[model samples]
Target: MKALHIITGLGVGGAEQQLRLLLAHLPVDCDVVTLTNPGAVADGLIDDGVRVVHLGMTGNRDLAALPRLVKLIRAGGYDLVHTHLYRACVYGRIAARLAGVKAVVATEHSLGDSQMEGRRLSTGVRALYLASERLGRATVAVSPTVADRLQRWGVPGPRIEIVPNGIDVARFRFDPLLRERTRRRLGLPEGAYVVGGVGRLTAGKRFDVLIRALAELPREYWLLLVGGGAEESVLRRAAHDAGVTDRVLFTGERPGGGLPGADLPSLTAAMDVLCSPCAEEAFGLAVVEAMAAGLPVLYVSCPAVEDLPPSAARGARRVQGGADSFVRALLRVRAEGAGPRSVPDAAHHYCITRSAAQLMDVYTAAVSCTSLGVSSS
Candidate 1:
């Protein structure tokens, strides 16, 4: 089946990474095209022989991309259009209908009582979303919290399906030899306890809070943050102001580089624990990666994180969702062991492969429902 997936950007983020997996793993003949600009994740798509149309949409919902987006959808003859992120979801659904695509679906990767940014904007978007949601075939909630959020926004009835983000557990499984080699190559002391995180240095991510919490911890614990964004300067300043700048490192945006997960997984395996202190998280990709690496995670409780089993509760000493708890949890994990344990498989039924398959089902269902003139029930 031909598929067209839309997202705000192909930048280094959880949803983008998930899209990368989808493009890579889908059936060889299945056509795929992206709505956002080609990014660090594009090389993989090209390698997989998938078509990527960089709308030059930039991240701001460019109207220019809309015409191209409409033309592309019409020309590609996509059977289904699956969208991620808010702008893309709205734009994709509208464009799909305008192009007369067979089916349209959107996934809610974030959940909230209020959005992280402008309330007025969220209100306006919610209104448009309500309209398209009624017109679209299916809606996917990355977590139960997202479902509630969509329902609160009056999403075309209660048909939203919960599809938690998943990882290729086998890919992230523990590798002691790789970790030792990575540490040696990076010149890190063999016994140093490295607390790491992989995410953009954004206000919502609360990397500053992590720095604040790290200042309270003992000196042996070093923090390594992967991924970068517009606020790297602000976050670095926050760390410097907190007097913990020396303890943290930023790898900046990789655009099209590789070393671990983005830099290659060795850095992941080298981490004793991955601390995701985001005040808000939709699916907590960084946390799950840590868990997959057998590295424990310390994060404040967030709705999307509800799907994750606390490492502490599973005998890994989880924090109580605060700065102090964060420090205590960090020390607790160190004293306990380096193994954070992988997420229980049952937690995420929506593996990338399975998620794509479900979209196919949703696609077929959308066709049938549309043909029957029945709305989502």
Candidate 2:
């Protein structure tokens, strides 16, 4: 079936990258539209021969863009309209209805307990989201954790589908040569313990806790932070204040653009451990990816692993508290020594192929239900 995927922007965040991976595996003709900045992920989509259109949406209240989107959707004659992210969900749903496309679906990729896409869940935001969500046939939550959040936010239980985010598992397999080369490229000593943190460097992510924790570690212990955001300077200042600036390495927004040491898997190969300090997380995708690379992970919260049994991701440990607690955990892990562990079952469970197949079922159900003229109830 012909489907058009709409998202707020095409930045290098988890949601954007997840959409790219999903499109590669879904068995359908699809095009993409980005409402604003067509950044790295947009380029990757184009490189993969996917049609990507920038809607030139100025901001959230860009009502003019709505009619334009409706016109585009109507002209495309798409059978389904799938949206990702918040702005796209709101506008894409209304535009699909105006464009006469009945089969509409959305994926809630980054819905945390109290925040979504790093934005606080204000009363108005909840009301607006619920209003637009009603226009869609189904809303896919990235995890059962997020499905619960959506239901709490007033989305009907039957209308919410749980399609956990997936990853290319084999691509992240631990490689000895890659590990050596990537560590050398990053100027890390062969035996140095690298504490890796991958995610958008936002205040909500609490990357600063890692910086503070780094100060308590030995000089040979290094901190590798992947991804970029508004909090880079804040994190840099924190690193400086902690007197561990020299040991902290920040790779600014690597989108796996074929860079040898910069790509995520290569960086994961070089890491000794992955640490996610964020107390609130939707799915903890990075943690899963790291586990796929056979790296041990420490996190404050990760629904993707927590929702499953302990054996699903044996290498991942959930640590409570802040920098002090992280420092203690780091010390314990250091004493145990760093080595590649067995890739946990959790990594295999979230394989991109499986997610693609599950999403196709969601698409099929939405389309068939819409054809019957049944309310998306």
Candidate 3:
């Protein structure tokens, strides 16, 4: 079936990269449209021969783009319109309906109990999201935790589909030579124990907590902050203030140039341990990537990892007391020494093939209902 995927600015975030990866695995003919800046992922999509349209939305309230989006959907004659991120979900669903498209699906990639779009959760914001969500046939949650959160936010249980985020397991498999090369390229000391965190450098990610945790660790322990955001300068200053600037490394916005410049597997190979201190994570993609790389993971709160089966949860440890807890976890893992661990079978469950298959099921269900003149919701 012909499908059009819509997303808020195509920057190099998890959701944007996930869309890029999903397109390669999905069986249907799909095109992409970005509401604003078509950034890095747009370039990657173009390289992959996917048609990407930029609406040039002035801002969040740019209502004029609605008609333009509707025209595009109608002209494309798409059987399904799949939306991602918040703004796209709201506007895409509306435009799909306006264009008379019967099947519309949205993926909820980053919503949690404490925050939505890295901002404080307010009643009005929740109301706006729920209202937009109702316009779609189904909402795909990246994790079961996200599905539970959607229900708590008033989305009907049946409308929420749990589809865990996937990673390239083989790409992240541990390789001693590659790890050494990656560390050398990144200017990391051979003997130092590395603690790495990946994702946008936003306040919600609590990189500050990670910096503080690093400060408390031994001098041989180093911090590698991957991914970039507006919080870069603030985090740099915090690192300097903590007197760990020498030990802390910032790889800027783009660390590795492979795969739209994310190069997650290479960067993950360089890390001795992975940390995700964000409490409001909808699904911990980086954490899973680390596990796939055979590195131990220390997380403050991540339901995605927590929900894994015991056999698959092998190198992951959850710590509670914030920075102090992080410090202890780091030291404990260091004491245990780095050794080869098998990539969990559960990790394989999140491969892109599985994600694509689950997504196709959602798409087929939505289209089947639409064809039958029955409400999917």
lDDT of 3 by residue, 108-170 (tens): 999988887796689888888888887889999999999988998899998988888887677
The whole-model lDDT of each prediction reads: 0.67, 0.92, 0.87
- CA displacement after TM-score superposition, residue 138 of candidate 3 (Å): 0.7
Question: Which residue ranges in model 2 land beyond 4 Å of their true spot?
Answer: 257-262
How does model 2 score by TM-score?
A: 0.98
lDDT (10s digit) by residue, model 2, range 198-281:
999999999999999899888888999999999999999999988999999999998852222337999998889999999889
lDDT of 1 by residue, 1-377 (tens): 56778776676666777767755555624444556656777666666566666776665556777778889889887777788877787778888888987477788776556662312336677777777776577898877777776777787445687766666656666777988887787667656788887777666777776778888988877777778877899978888988888778776764322212454466788778777776656666666555556665676644534655543324223355667778877777777764435654432433456766765566677667766777544
TM-score of each candidate? 0.87, 0.98, 0.97
Clashing pairs in 1: 259-263, 259-264, 260-263, 260-264, 261-264, 294-340, 312-317, 312-318
lDDT of 1 at 170: 60
RMSD of 2: 1.5
**Higher-lDDT candidate among 2 and 3?**
2
Error of 1 at 51 (Å): 0.5
TM-score of 1: 0.87
Candidate 2 lDDT for residue 348: 92
